[model samples]
Target: MPAPATPEAPAGWDFSDVVGSDSSLRRFLHGLPGVDQVGAEARAAQLGTRSIKTTAKAFALDLAIRMVDLTTLEGQDTPGKVRALAAKAMRPDPSDPTCPPAAAVCVYPDMVADVKQVLGDSGVKVASVATAFPSGRAALDVKLADTRDAVAAGADEIDMVIDRGAFLSGRYLQVFEEIVAVREACTAADGREAHLKVIFETGELQTLDNVRRASWLAMMAGGHFIKTSTGKVQPAATLPVTLVMLEAVRDFREATGQMVGVKPAGGIRSSKDAIKYLVMVNEVAGADWLDPDWFRFGASTLLNDLLMQRTKMTTGRYSGPDYFTLD
Candidate 1:
């Protein structure tokens, strides 16, 4: 069970007027209303039925393109691969210049420098996965160093995985404090703090209730964005999971007057799936969360699908997989 909430506010959000004392934090998280799985799923399914066509489809395609964090997180990733992916991000469809570039290219920490070099002046950001990435088992010092290395290497953004072990075991304070420390480490040498994205690996969190709690925890701990997965886990980024997170961000904003972005990574492969997610964002999180700055899709193959659909929209013909370059 989670701890209780205290009356006093924690130091982190004193300025924001959201008192977050340890007991209060626990009370807030644990006291959060439980998720109704059936109702939430029904809502997502119903929203998925919203038909987007013609100009709306065109707009969604472009918006989805701009919202993509075109990712390549393989252990075997090379500089050559990174460059190819960066090129894809800059010009998703070489045949069509109207297609906007993806939001950023996500990679492992060690590849940030190479990605930054390849993507110079393209306006596409470089995001690195740190805080032990894929797994949050490292010591705090090691995690901080990992984050610092990525920021120093020119990562425009940092995606850190929370210590799920600690979180599930009721160590919310440890999880919160770790995020605060990493948020501090996001400060680059140039005095700009790289955007911090907290990934919950929601697949392992087991329930929508936990996803909601984790989302609130991440936002309260100063996550500029809350991500759904690392793309390495099974069941990585599901509709229900992302829906729960969207609601969390929506409520967090209503309660605290702060806006945080949401990223649903992994398993989202087609334009249809992407559009469904957008529908949910529009209806559940409000249209204000529609921009790339407020939302992102951490995806690889989803780009090709968007490109193909865009081609169909333009030429009235579907392009084959051979037409789009592999990244």
Candidate 2:
């Protein structure tokens, strides 16, 4: 028998627009408007000045809490560590039950089982960093195995790092194909497939132009979400870099009628900073992207800051770091 037919693209959508010969891909990416670095930075800085207060502040705080991908990706991470992280994710503020739980708990592939066991049926998701996470230097087979193992271990989402080496070397097609392959590897044996978030590690990509191209490349290659960084680099995530990514997702949705998510990991630690990011999302991607489903913060300490601020809002006083559990 012939091979099974692949599912059709969404109505009025065409994958051909993005997939093509190497030359065509280059032309397409190059044809994209060049990034005005100064202008982009100025805009991000300007948006950062917008002051959210009172009721709006409260709303944004809660939304930010829910959008967090409570993360712990470290050489020292253990099952005990992951379990503690999951507990914090389930109840971010021990003093107040009204504070919403984070959207997901992110971990390394080997720890997904522990996180799942801790979370049980609380509806919090488990996100795994795979595909030779933090460094996409492994063989393709190893990467795929890494992704499959995470999914089999019950990860609801997979954050895969793209081959920046291939991308910077002008091997755009290789990078795109890698994303597609890893996305496929997210499938579970029972026919379920975890959502795939492709990390561009824009810090190493070196230019806003490169960031824009990588964003489009990942989206075109079937990444359910295009992420800013892997949280291990110098400039893991920045307002300007994330602004460029948000624009890509917004534009992709306008053209394809398919909305892809965006996650900005690393460097975002304060409730104030998180709110500023929320403002950027609203202005750049519109209210549609404000929800946890479309946007996520890949953070570890960000949750605690949000909790402290949340307590301040509720009790009219700032709670020290001691108030929250140390995960």
Candidate 3:
């Protein structure tokens, strides 16, 4: 089959025209090229087998380490726990200062201040999950308040979940407006708005086509990054789902000249699995997206594995799992 047509936004594509009404947004979203489920899965599986050489493997491992968003989003999260996580984010390996810090440390809004205290000037960002994260079922006002609170607490990035009920039920405009509002609520300190990461919880989306549409929808609404899952759902961040999302961001930039990021969260545990994602990003989204800013792995346990691999590669001996803190 011929490659899918690019939903390249028409030159000078105006956001207002598309979001002017439910009908307009629906028409544009539904008209986008349909996803080929079989093709996407086959491509993801094929790319997963590509091998990396020893030298490149070392670099890719470190790059993957840097791309990780070390996260601890639990109901029992305390200031002490948040502080420890922050420490780990800043220094994945206490023994080696060469180990680059993770891209950010993600936590609940209430823990942002505690994390900030530990990560001060250390370069590890404080990312908070807001807008009724993991479950975007609350009212719009409640969600906006949640977002504002996180930003006020110095969150560099806000991860908001979309109202899947609205999207699946054909309330695309409502979902669009919610994202727009949450993005607005992401106030920044230095005149730069906090980056907004829109989470689709792909497993809940049910199909590759939905993933593509949701990815486009989030980007169009000003999401700095489009994320796969909240890690609370089953089958989160599968390679096929991530492949579809990467394609959306690639095509979006082609049309709008705007670069959006992609994050595949949850279920990615080992260094081997993380490297597969790196290969996919390089192959599917191009080399420009290989950086931590353009892509991320929202994970808790992934960092530890990357540390272990790095240790083995440098010391020529596998430092058993106990060598690193249990993230």
Clashes of each: 10, 0, 0
Cα lDDT, all candidates: 0.89, 0.90, 0.91
Flag clash pairs in model 3: none
Clashing pairs in 2: none
> Tens digits of per-residue lDDT for model 2 on 1-327?
111122234644666855777888888887777778888899899999999769999999999999999999989999999999999899887668899999999999999999999999999999999999899999999999999999999999999999999999999999988898999999999999999999999889999989989988898899999999898998889999998888888777776788899999999999999999999999988999999999999998999899888888889999899988776
lDDT of candidate 1 over 147-262, digit per residue (tens): 99999999999999999998898778889989999999999778988999999999899888899999988988889999999988988998888888888887777666788999
> What TM-score do all the candidates reach, one by one?
0.94, 0.95, 0.97
List candidate 3 segments past 4 Å from native: 1-3, 188-192
lDDT of 1 at 49: 93
lDDT for 269 (candidate 1): 92
CA shift of 56, model 1, Å: 0.3
> How far in Å is the alpha carbon of 50 misplaced in model 1?
1.0
